[model samples]
Target: MSALWRRSDLVRATGGSAHGAWQDVSGVVIDSRAAGPGDLFVALHGPNHDAHAFVGQALAAGAAAALVDRADDHPSLAGLPVDAALLRVADTLKGLERIGVAARARSRARIAAVTGSVGKTSTKEALRHVLAARAATHASAASHNNHWGVPLSLARLPAAARYGVFELGMNHAGEIAALVATVRPHVALITTIAPAHLAFLGSIEAIADAKAEIFDGLEPGGVAVLPADSPQFERLRARAAAAGATIVTFGRSATADCRLLHAVSDLSGSDLSVRLHGRMIDLRIGTPGEHGIANALAVLATVEALGADPVQAGRSLAEVAPAAGRGARVPIRLAGGEALLIDDSYNANPVSMAAGLSVLGRASGRKIAVLGDMLELGPEADRMHAGLLEPIDRQDVDLVFTVGRHMQALHDALDAGRRGGHTASSDKMVPLLREMLRPGDTILVKGSLGSRMKVVVEALTDGEAAGVRPQAN
Candidate 1:
């Protein structure tokens, strides 16, 4: 939404050419679906499909220009009117990255970068909410936390914004550094070092090390926020200190300058109690997991550490809601009463699975966990899935539905009373789960994106047979 780009500058930067009145260009885009009028649409070439094919659609959407890798002057583009500023790029994705770096370099805002196994979106959203109330803030949209996502978010930054927030993510080494360098934040926050992305990261220590790379772009005196309750708390503090960052901490620790006092959570998530620099603050969060409460505390501390008011930050965080697949709650009306659904199917790993189960346990209805494969765990996959059974009974979750190959381990480990059924695919699992639904039953659906567990949530929420979408939240 920033008017900071110029076509002539892009031509010089990418060694490309522009046609017909591109000098006053302002906006950049990769997705034609989100393009607005006067936007520069860059048709990036992806592995499965070339975006060059979408140039016509971008133009149809009132796009001012299109930069495409149409080397042969694809026939589809020839039909475009002469007024359209159609240009060429050797690679549009790479060109977007170059443009992002230029946008970041030009921004005058105080920037904060967030990354971790979980809570990056919640934390980033919290910061954006807290900061935007006081200043013109720019934040990453959705889970834009990858190589392309980082630049895309940065490119959306306005030149005159007073603050910016980017959620950086990686499943392997060296990815964060590239994005972080482009962001160059005044503050950085690593939510926690959990066992995620192990298929590439190898070990928890390696994960922590990879997470610490968020500081690679910190300006001198930039702050880094870490959770004091995390297992790698000291290691993270040391890593940031080693990287020449000033560390700020939050959690239940007495020494932590920012801390949590209590949380009132049920099937419908939680209301949080926060303590910052000696002032106690009350807040409401849209998630029930203890992890969510802790993450909210972390966000409050980080915002204050970056010079925002802790009180206002805590107040603003109450407005932050969970995304549907992440932690949205839906209630199902049953024959006698109702049922609750915790939809956490957006993503999964060992850490988040346990967190989701914990939230399931706190619900008042008959607790059931609809779990799917947590991919990319490397060797620890089965043990982690089976390990969750320990807390399932302890937390009083009555039934557990395991799906996919990785989840077969959890399926095999379940006892007769708690074991629901193992379905190989989400499509098959949905109808059966639908049949089992009764009033006052609390269902939790969670899995990696590959597992498509959110489909179950969609069916449950939108299924006309089951009553209706839950109002539990």
Candidate 2:
């Protein structure tokens, strides 16, 4: 593979001075510990900790060069070799953005940007999977869809790629606007609008307004892929129209450009019949839940918008497995037998929490739900937490275990027979969960990232505990 960035190009892009003999870097990385040979380590200064302290460590780990605002002032680079490659800039963050912008400008690839209240990462990944089968595809790694992450992923974009899929995420109103300005994608997709980040943005309408910002940076004649089922559909469509975008929607709604006709879901996956622009196609996604179907529809809509082969894209949907901490199924080796674990512990809101419960309802064992607080709902946090009782009941979950202060509402709301345990934190809930597990049990674990529910997942999978191992879907 060719170098992602050359020394001369880096100098031109960031308007920085380069020192030392290094000529090229194959990748860009912000985390010093993860930096490796042929990687450009960008030392970013954040509120909590300055990565400048780890410059030496990154270089020692074989990074080709280091991007830094302070080369001489930092004590970490005191005894570095005189020939060590260093790119000095006014600000490392802005420098990274410049490199990203440069990458976007020079690439001839058909680019797509995905942003939503939920399913942005999943939809982005699905697009990558579908497009990669057709041509050279580049996408944001993991959930690299923020200020620094967006640019970092963009800067890492290979010039030879035919398609670029980027996931743009935000916690505030203007965040996506700024990030999308850098992306300027030909296809901009919003998975759905939900009450995510309500604590900061205030109302769900405000949240729609914030998410609709993805259209602000659409390239000329760009296509906007939206959810027809969203209550904010017309609001988003109007915003996309205002941005001069060609609108395409996906959902169960008959008016959707890409519409789901029928779906049958089980614990493992789902089989669905969908109509794309009036052409019906059968798709089987390895990921379960109705939400997975919605994500697949969004992916297919993006595929059509990008002018790729729909047949190939539809076929690729079967290979898309659930990402870790996002509904991956794991098999735990209990003393008596094995139990299934649905790992949805990445992040959560009321919509996702309900979807998880619905998936749990499909399982053929004693259904268990281990929930954590859904953060950032603002004043309605308590009501939202307690509202999950409806889905829990609808899904007929046998036992419910909740973590965090906010989830106490759900715990208090559960009937006596269904309430398993409740704790202030995931750590305290681990032991109580272990004692209750039995053979033929299927457990679904979910919560927001702030709740640290992954701790419970780790505890259950630990060798000292249940000795859990992930089983293929």
Candidate 3:
């Protein structure tokens, strides 16, 4: 707790009045359960739950103090046993943002902001892994890329950090601009633009525009790492130029500064060679998928832009692993034999769905796709869902189990021989998949977060598929 945040500094940054004995804080936490000794817990009020109600719990969990808006008439204040400091503010969310801004001002870390319709979290994690090898790196934990997540991640930045990686996410326009302004990164990476939030934004072009907003907050003469192979490459390059950023491209495009020279893949992983600004580097990725290789290229571009050794970063790719729910693999012990379960149950869009299918196609076993709806896909949702049939056919998938209303279209479009089953909800589909699975089967479960496809993954892993019955809809 030496210099994370002084009591006077917190007051000045948050524009709040301090009550009780003020003290310095070593950490910042939003969840009471995560609060540790010397931590400053910010009591946030959300729609379903209120963090303010857990102030006492946070203190008991060893939080040094609590940041709350209510002081005089709050119910939680009267029950406090310990004499912990209270930083009272008008609004806790704004206070968190101010603290983030102050933290950015105090640190000299080379910052990078990442945003895209897909792969933001994965690319951010890759950057963290590659950069942390050479410097003190700080990055957003989990998918902390929204308004609250961005500020909270920044507020947690240590003053001595040499690198800071922030993921900026948005479902609509202007959101990325606002989040990136808080980060003000020296480098910005747009993984690839796809149809993610089409329900709100309407078209892929609009989504591309939304993702391009990350460049708005680029520091003067900062670097913009973009996917040269993407259809919206020129549009993104123009936007980056307008934001006064130096453009750096990565992909199979010959002109890209970081270009993929060759990629050889097997059931285990991928062996790849990349040409970074004409310097060739070879590496092995523990994860499978063409997207993984693309993510590696972005990581290399980011590390080089930050003045870190791209060669060292390239070597680190050999040890890179997927974050849970993205593409974490698990071995399922079946009665017949062990099967491979690809847990891509986190979230999905059309672009990511096809990528996951491509990975499943490479498996050294029978391929099964237990898919859920790609949510937030506006008017053309049904068409987009059914369009996945092409990838399924291309992958030579043996069976397909689909869930969610949108995915029903895909199920119906599939050849009757290949269709395992379909249901209106993931709950109903889980039991059917359990019965359908066999030895040497590689199953890929994916969908948007709203689809809750993770339950299917859980049911399989928990070995409840055989015992549980599908509930009547």
lDDT of each: 0.81, 0.91, 0.89
Q: Which residue pairs in model 3 clash with each other?
A: none
Residue-by-residue lDDT tens digits, candidate 3, 1-473: 46588899999999998877758899999999999899999999888888889998998888888999856677767777545578999899999999999999998999999988788899999899989999899999999999899999999999999999999989889999899988999999999988888889988888888898988898898999999999999999999999989999999998999999999986557898998987889989877898888888899998999999999988888887876689988877676577888999999989999999999999876898999999898999999999999999998998898998888899889889899899988888876776767767888989888889988888888766434332221
Segments in model 2 whose C-alpha atoms lie over 4 Å from true places? 467-473
- What are the RMSDs of all candidates, in order? 3.0, 2.8, 2.8
TM-score of model 3 (CA atoms):
0.96
Q: Which candidate is the best by lDDT?
A: 2
Q: Which ten residues in a row have the lowest lDDT in candidate 3?
A: 464-473
Report the lDDT tens digits of candidate 1 across residue range 50-119: 7777888987887888887636567666776676677677777877787788788777888999998987
Q: How do all the candidates rank in terms of TM-score, highest first? A: 2, 3, 1
What TM-score against the true fold does each predicted structure earn?
A: 0.93, 0.97, 0.96
- Residue 360 error for model 1, in Å? 1.3
Candidate 1 lDDT score relative to the true structure: 0.81
Task: Name the lDDT of candidate 3.
Answer: 0.89
Candidate 2, backbone clash total: 0
Model 1, which residues run further than 4 Å from truth?
Answer: 1-4, 12-15, 23-26, 70-83, 334-337, 467-473
